[model samples]
Target: MQKRILLSLIVLLGACSTEKPDTVSIESQDDMKHASSVAANSTENREEVSLSLLEKSDSKYSYKLNGMKFSSNDRVLKKGSVVQSLSESGSGLIKGSFVVIASQLPKGVIEHYEVNEIATSTYRLIPLEIGGDLYELYQALRQNDVFSRVEIEIDYSGKQTSDSF
Candidate 1:
């Protein structure tokens, strides 16, 4: 009887220690399904949508600012900065990292700006500086004739996937 009781206690402890966490949240399931379907459609019709705009992530808004919920963990602007929404900008220019492609890489661009070259003429501008707002930076780069196009780099840091799975 003593041995049986000890064995039962050990098994109970082992079971508790090996318990799995609940990974699925029904609240975000619809968002995930919509995103996946959009991805499938994009693959079928390449030109129908811009591939650069599609992003997959599981991050949720923890708080609200100015009555708007920001999904990204990394806030692109300074802590106290007021974010201008699409209505205000009239261009849907939300704050985030952007990929700036230019016809020519201008001189002295690295002095006040830090960028990572992704391809021959493609460069990624990381929005880490206090004054490095995406819209403002794009405008600044656009003043020079060297820049051809500026696009927002989709933030995908919110996607949750397990390495063991």
Candidate 2:
């Protein structure tokens, strides 16, 4: 009887210990809840844009991202990939103190994107500015304790125009 009571208490405490899920649980493609079973529609050796990494900063950090939006008629990004990071020279001021990737996306649409969740209230969104940034997607990946990999999607439907409007 004592053993039974102890086992019951242990199970009860285990259930209440920690139930929260990890933030970066989507490391593998199998983790995708609704991956498009309709084979990806892309091409080979196609012309694609490249993104440059933002330069490193010297002083204190500034700017907390609120929202990010990137849409191109040619390709749409998945819900967990990070948009390519802009080279420090590209942004001109803010450097590589922070980065962003996709956490939630609307639907199948834009081709390239990099969105990362820095904190509860802050998120970095990288929407490709031009076609040249596509090739640079791999370079943007930064292996860190917080961020593991930048998830993305590539679409080659022959349309290169970004859906900003």
Best candidate, TM-score-wise?
A: 1
Question: What is residue 60's positional error in candidate 1, in angstroms?
Answer: 19
Model 1 clash pairs are 58-158
Each model's Cα RMSD:
18.9, 22.1
Residue 72 lDDT in candidate 1: 35
| TM-scores of all predicted structures | 0.35, 0.19
lDDT tens string, model 2, 1-165?
999999999999988866676565556676564343322322211212111121222222222121223322223222222232222211221122234343443332135435455676345545555334332333344332243433333222333343421
Query: How many times do residue backbones clash in model 2?
Result: 33
Q: Write the per-residue lDDT of candidate 1 for residues 57-156, one digit (tens) a residue.
A: 3332122333333343334443223333333331122334556678666766766556789998898765446555454565566566777776554323
- State, as a TM-score between 0 and 1, how close model 2 is to the true structure: 0.19
Which candidate has the top score in lDDT? 1
